[model samples]
Target: MTAKQDAQLTGVPSAAMTSLLPGPLVDDAWLAEHLDDPRLVVLDATALLPSPRHDGDHRSASGRPGWAERHLPGSRHADLTSDFSDPGAPCHFAVPTPEALSAALARLGVGEGSEVVAYDTGGGIWAARLWWMLRAISVPAAVLDGGLAAWQAAGRPLASGDTHPEPAVTPAVPVLRPRLWSGIEAVAAISRGEHPGVLVCALPPGGYDGSAPTRYSRRGHIPGSRSLPGRGLLDDTGRLLPRAELAARVGAVLGTADSPVVLYCGGGISAAGTALALTVLGRRDVSVYDGSLEEWSGDPARPLETGG
Candidate 1:
């Protein structure tokens, strides 16, 4: 076969990736080039919940004012409180059930086989959470490599006016593989180092220590866990570093796929970001400690260990 045909047959794209990001996850340029691809569905997940901190957030709890000011020409907003959240779940940004998630995606004009790209302005925390939700539902999706900042830096076109997408034809409930999830019980076991695994602390140094994180009621991480701040994975430009650098940095903390790697942050949001990084690095067996330190430290029985 010709080189191009060979590459395509092998599931690798013909050209070298312009950015360090994987082909499945596009950068600003790639997204700009494919703006009219018809297959792309971009979602803007850029709002804080309607809590005391809501108004302080740029999105103002209802809509992302920044997105209103300017956004990717075809992007639709994903309301955190209304669209992609589980009201019943005790934790913040918990994964909604399949039915709830399916309905939410349908409203956002996402359907089966849609190439969904999610983004947030800040570090990829919000975008990564939604991307994990999509994967949980068996939808083909990914996050924008560096989010809105990168997009605007590349001089991409922006549009005004609220673009309401037509409702999608809801497909059958996807047959999801119940993996990549760890509950409080599993986190407890990790705290005791019962299973003997790697625990990633994606929080700031102070939060990773015994000091209570501002976001969570309790602070500190599971016993025997290592403090590998999620920011270490990002570059000076706020983009994920090159794969080789990421591999090197993560190699010490993360072993083989067979070796279980449990990740957690204040309330499991940043952990999802780490999980996505691990996924891009081709570690398939990784799972997020969903309850994270929030649930683990809630109980007095669980021992808390501070310091890196």
Candidate 2:
């Protein structure tokens, strides 16, 4: 693997956010009040990845149509799975170069001083994916807790039709934050126990246990990873669990270990949702495995483990 293979994610240098969010995660109540802020850019980064056999997210379905049917009043579609991905990469949803990402952000009207709030309908994973991508390059961004469902449940108004905001005047190029991204090398080292830190698998139970279908060529998870499905971090309404409860969920696995944590899942999507949860819990050392199982499992020599 080359340098690019190690850390696929990149972003602009940390620019001041005109409208600072309370934290990395925000609720519908807060967003409702800030809808009119010119510096605030809300993106429905909802990319649906269903099964390969069906017209699911990974294959044909797109969140654009759903965004068309109904979305936040001033929100635009930030196509994380496509527009922001490196189409030439071997795996799915590959993070593009800094130049590519800066261009994409410009297209989304995210210029310097912009505050991004990403939300998704399929769950917070897609939104979290966007958040992780931006934060990796020092962009000021956050995920909408519970996503579109929470927005609707709060009786917030929605609008149909597309939003084509004019390009940002001068979008700054992002600098990659290497620590936030773990390439295949880091994951393998951690898996082999040569590297310090825990390997956390954020996929569902079936995926972790090798009992469910996978998008990758192999089944099961990386060796020595603990099961913490991304969806498990969210409550029934799609909002993240309360802070104290969230601490308990993560603490159960982390304990007093205070070590670096590398998170991964199929194609690095859902793992981000878990990363968001950890960030909410104040763990800045968290990094998502960029390639995740899609890359790891591709090489049979890498090794895998199954069962609870």
Candidate 3:
């Protein structure tokens, strides 16, 4: 057999390792310990969310200003609203194309061989979004377990001002993985029972029940979806729950269905938390609805359901 065939027999690579990550989740202690690793590129992917309102769609702001004011000592800001999203897409936070993804990573000093750690100020929701993006492309990355608050609580040092590094010597080449993302058509199919899988809404319970205010014109979840709020997946400390506890919660909602899971949120940001949680539980049959409620609600013809 050829060398390629022989190498393929085992999942291990024949060459020396090019990149490494501490899995999809890492606590503040792990980050503090490896703060100085040359191959590590830490990012603050915080997005300032608007306070909950009883009336209408809430506005969100880029967390760059806050990130610029203070961030992890060696970290830089990753503007998820602009740089990491598709500017031309009508819906906000639209996933970027492979080229845009590559350019953004390259500009951020992330090469094919780079290891990444992502965190946010409020919770790890925003950080989980970035981690999901990197993982979808097979880039080694992890979400800081408890985020900036945890780091600060642990008395870690922080820095202010611009810390943007030089462009990566080797630009990132996105190798898109299969079934990591699902489009509107597939989601619509699922809603119509033309498809077989689980539709999980990862927003707060309000979003699932249609009682919550929404940025989109209409509130409520897509038809036949189950609630699995991403916020519920985390503990009071913002770290993930124990694996057994997590599995129990997830399994309870999923309920013995071996079908693939399709996760979605108001825009698309919070769903990553559920995706990350599922990944931590050793699930690979998952996909994120890129359009999510933004796109689904944009079209009035689509049906929605009120209440859980």
Candidate 4:
């Protein structure tokens, strides 16, 4: 059957009827209460990010085994490195086409009406990527506030092994929000002073300053971009910081909430974490550079800078 037919059969609404929840982040208590709701779809969007010293081959370094071993009850696995990304792209985890994304979500029983709650074992990094992808398609979704760590800390039940529900139907026509992404051209423009926005590098300080071991074509970072590691947005326990603290830290780099912001990391994974933090902090005009340094550093024409 055609995607539209499948969507109609499964009760997936069209674009006009799509509605998002009030907040992008949900606490463990909120998720526990809604866990058994028929309309709710929980996804363990866990991924093991590539090490700085390794090339951008995330498929070989994924956390799928952990998901198979244990995950939140009734949650399905969403593989960011493979299933949800563009396999043909030059860099790892390139955003997939709307059709590809819709198919992946459908396989996980996520429809237009499905209220998705995405979480990860690696805190919020991978989960936020799924959340951002859902937003791109106008699907209503949220991230589990502290992910698996928080849920386990609360003594929640866990289920092992894989679970496959019947596929869900969503709108055949997916909404692609261009503004939500910054392409290489956009980054180049920003680099050459042809575009206006604050470029935020979401890697670690070592990665930002060229002191970290790297496997990219070049070391260093995009010149003029501020270094605000995505991990800094979270506490030692992996929970996000309080709103006041988040506002102050991000505000210090962004200057104003009205300023356009572009977030990028090694291969666009950690960047999503910062994007999620910004969303919780009430920043509206934020976008992720999909290629990030993976694409930037690989190009010989692009310039890189070292040191703070």
Candidate 5:
């Protein structure tokens, strides 16, 4: 395979990697070099386990039990089912309140302007959630390319620590914003194609096709939505592809940064990952379908499109 093709397949890059996305994702070697850099904070956004299979298992869902098992040195857990998301919400893991998120950040030593890196066992799928959350809160962060598995494969050293990173002082609320999320009513009105919209199923082809279901009310996707699978942005190493390549892949499928994109997945976690990728690709007009298929698919009046 050609060098570029190999990079796409494995999601790993040699020393020199560049991206059109504003921020850059670090690999295991790079991360190891800066593990002690106070300016850089690392996080593990592994999926909350015991969840539906779609969430995957980067870490166990048994709370701190999973984190204690093993993680990047000095890294803290960003529980998708708890920390940055609202557990009481109907959308499964909807974005948490900015106030709650700020607190979570303080605990993670992620104050305003902190450069953060996140990773999960899978490719960027779970790690991207944290990346998106930081963006949503206006914190500058990126996912570690190739995740922990990649780090281990490279024969990198691992650290097991019982001590947690001290929290940072709460900073101002994050300024992260995405295209306005439409509710069920808005979705119903917009699906007629009058708005020139793009509804993206952030899950893999299987999830979008109803072949692999998550904790959603229904198995299908929003009517007329396209499958872009946030997971596609990652290479075999579980790291993000170079920015230029990612832009080409994501832009070609969704049009361009200027195109109106609405992203969603089982609940909204995975969709956030896709939205973050678009934002990194310089797409400013993207929004997350917060209610997503979870809210739209079961309604008799709403439409459901099924295909891989």
Candidate 6:
């Protein structure tokens, strides 16, 4: 095999490794070549966000049915809504306990030395959520840039129905990185201007400006947060923008790499997209508010404001 192909399969050093490795995003070509690597676990972490017009439980919206119909060959579906998140939490997309997360991942055949590649049918919003979950537990993971859309566009083969590998024997013990996530109390303090950091709302201008339809009790954003919609980071094909462009967009609000950034959206899903964007820009001091506006706006006590 050529050196490039070898690198793709084993992550061995090659000219292309410079751009592919030491990062959080990989393209469809890289994943396709490595699809059969024993040390790799490719997860279709597909979860559709509920439409604002549909007033129902957002937690019930899942991409499993679609995944069951078609997905990457040999890729197992990782249900973010049910398997990876806290279903009993007060709001949608709450982070599950490390133990719960570890067990769920183990059942998906993930273990030590496994290089995880997560992707979704849509833009990488849901896939990034799973990447963040793995990162929170200190696992080595990356999101498929452009996701399944790009894969299919590349004329890759697809497999349908369920495919289960043996459950992993090694337990996934999470290191419990508290700094990777922010809770409601921490967000409240940040909103109150008692904390030293920037609160970023990753929803669209409408949600941030209070002009959009909302499922939350309140229709606006956290009082002191700034608007930096996560979708703005992606291009027409659902792939992230060029590095220079991405840096410019995030830098406008973040100012410096040292700036502590707390990202949030309708729920935690999109915020993870922004978090992944920041990581791509080499910013380490970033955290996603897990409950996001779901818990914030639903509570009568939390403060929210509308308009830019």
Candidate 1's C-alpha runs over 4 A off are 1-24, 49-63, 255-258
| Model 5: lDDT to the true structure | 0.67
Model 5, range 1-308, lDDT digits (tens) per residue? 56533332223332343322225356677778877876677888876544566532223352344556887778887777678777778665677777788788778787754668888775566777667666555565667777888888888866776578567566656664443454666555557766666777888787788776556555677777778888787666655668888888886776643547777886666787776567556565666767776677656677676775
Instruction: Report the Cα lDDT for residue 103, model 5.
Output: 80
User: What's each prediction's TM-score?
Assistant: 0.84, 0.91, 0.92, 0.90, 0.79, 0.90
Which residues of candidate 6, in runs, are more than 4 Å off? 1-22, 54-59
Ranking by TM-score: 3, 2, 6, 4, 1, 5
With candidate 4 superimposed using the best TM-score fit, by how many Å does residue 174's alpha carbon deviate from the native? 1.3
Which candidate would rank higher by TM-score, 2 or 3? 3
lDDT of each: 0.69, 0.82, 0.82, 0.81, 0.67, 0.82
Each prediction's total of clashing residue pairs, residues at least 3 apart in sequence or on different chains, is 0, 9, 0, 0, 13, 0
lDDT of 1 by residue, 1-308 (tens): 66533322222244542222233356887777776766677888776532223211212254466677778887888876666878798765667778888888878877765667888876776777777777766565678888888987887777876756586667537646466677777766766767756677887677678554345454566777777778778887667879999888888665553667778886566777777777777676667776676566667887777666
TM-score of 2: 0.91
Q: What's the residue-level lDDT of 155 in candidate 2?
A: 89
Mark the 10 consecutive residues where model 4 has the least summed lDDT. 5-14
lDDT of 2 by residue, 1-308 (tens): 33332222222222342236667888899999888988888999888777644211246346898898999988999887678888899888988887788778878888777878999998899999989988877677888988889999988899998756576557667867878889998888888889998999999898899877777777888888998888877789888888888888888877888889999998888999998888777676889898998889888898988898
Top TM-score: which candidate number?
Answer: 3
Model 5 residue 148 CA deviation in Å: 1.1
**Overall local distance difference test of candidate 3:** 0.82
